[model samples]
Target chain A: MKKIALGLLQVAGLTVFSLLVNTLTSLLHIPLPGSIIGMILLFLLLESGVIRLNWVEVGASWLLAELLLFFIPSAIGVMKYSKLLEADGLQVLAVVLVGTFAVMAGSGVLTGAIYRIKERRSS
Target chain B: MITGLLFLGLTIAVYLLAKRIYASSGKMYTSPLIITPLLIIAFLLMTGSSYESYNAGGKWLSDLLQPATIAFAIPLHKNFKVLKKHAAEIAAGVLSGTVIAVISSMLLAKWLHLSGDLATSLVPRSVTTPIAMSISQSIGGVPSITAVFVILTGVLGTMMGPSVLRLFRIDNEIARGVSLGTAAHGTGTSKAFELSSLTGTISSIAMILTALFSIGLAPALIAVFLH
Candidate 1:
């Protein structure tokens, strides 16, 4: 009972932090996601030693461990509009797939190039 | 109501099977994100279960994504030292990559004759959902459509990014992480985490940076190119 209560408390703490940041972002119109804002806030707290890692580590780890699972439902949210997408789906996929490759390729090559330049200059 | 609970149970059962297959096969070709969703989709097809019914359970689980995203900061915090070391280079790389992505998507939309709204929506699909949605709405695009495109881009990028990077011989964790996150956002970050914890942390930072940059860039882009 104590274990469950402690776990719930930790999760509640993290959730409260997340909601607080979410609210702030909306109020401020920050153009960034509330979750990312929440993340930055957590990072600041950790950095300042205001919030120890152990305080939220367990809850955070559990959430991250199954992060992909949470995305599935949202991903599959595609199916709700399956009919409208049926004709244009291939076109859409083509654009998206090509775009993905371009993005990855561009980022990877640029980062690698920068790394090499930095390495060569240092050496 | 029972459908929601039953659907959730079914998902867990299917996930285990998918996990076993993924492990046994050495995680080649199929990802849990891809394969498990395919299985559930197929099951829905066979069972004639509506997406809304499945979403009844799915939505509750998906709610966890908000906190999960916030929790991503833990990894970023742990890797702050390395982040500080390479901050400038990381920024340059992510900045160029996002520009390249936005440009390529715009060019592609033109070449394909995508409608005005569609083109506007597709431009920010490289970023994660929230940022992409915000950008889409601000630019006179359908946020829902942008979400679909963003999710699809992420799934495809995570599925093929590693091999594609291998073609360029870009094997460094920093490169991989930054590229994956910049290109595919959260989905790619999950794949990066699969590669290494350090890489995942870097990906989180890269993902956040790319979203922030795209926010500023999206307006100028549409004004200059689309108009």
Candidate 2:
């Protein structure tokens, strides 16, 4: 019973915080993403020790554990565009495949190289 | 009512299958990010139902994205020190990588004479799905196409990241995390967590940096190149 109540409270707290950040961002016309703003707010609260790590962990883990479940609706949006996909399916696939590889390779190599340079300079 | 129940059951089943596959493979290839979509695709193929119908029930699931995205702060907070230390280099790497991703892909598509629609579709390929979809819509690209590309990019990054890291002998946790996050977004960041907590933390920061950088840069690049 205690654990369940605590869990519920954590969820409520997170939701409230999320709403607050989002509301503030919109009201103030902040250019950052609402979720990003929420994240930053959560970080500040945690860092300030207003919300302990344990308090946030239960709810955070639950959210992260099923993260991909949240994307189903958007992924299913693919159905609405099936006709468009069929029309340019091959081209889309080619671009995705090639473009994905390019970013992965380019970013990975560059990050790795720069990190090495930084390590040498620091050491 | 019956249709809703059926759709809910299907979503859970697919999620379970994805988790099981991930457990068995011990590799990022079978991540829920990859499996869920594939399973959903298979379900659609078998049922012949439109995405709209599936989404009718799936929207409940998508609502969780808000909290899940917020949870990223936990990891980010934990890694504040590491983030501060490498902040400059990490920022530069993410910014450059994002610009190169959008510009190079657009140029490549143009050189190949791909259609404008397809060119726009590829414009947001490096960002996460939600932002990518928005960018696609604003730039007259097909949102669904961008979503598929975003997922594919994430899956490819999650699957190939470690191998590429090993090949290049890049073993730093910060480097690994940022690279994965920048290239793959949340999906790759999840995989980064599996390798090490530090890697996961760094990846979360990378995900944010890449998203922000791309969102700010993509519109300008699209206007200049695709317009």
Interface RMSD of each: 1.3, 2.1
Model 1, which residues run further than 4 Å from truth? A1-9
What count of clashes does model 1 give? Answer: 0
What lDDT score belongs to each candidate, Candidate 1 first? 0.83, 0.76
Clashing pairs in 2: none
Worst 10 residues of 2 chain A by lDDT: A71-80
Best by TM-score: 1
- The residue ranges of model 2 lying beyond 4 angstroms of the native Cα positions read A1-9, B27-29, B137-144, B223-227
Q: Put down candidate 1 lDDT per residue, B131-210, tens digits, no spaces.
A: 88988999888999899888888888887887887887878888888888999999899888888998888888889999
Candidate closest to the true structure, highest DockQ: 1
Rate residue B53 of model 2 by lDDT: 74
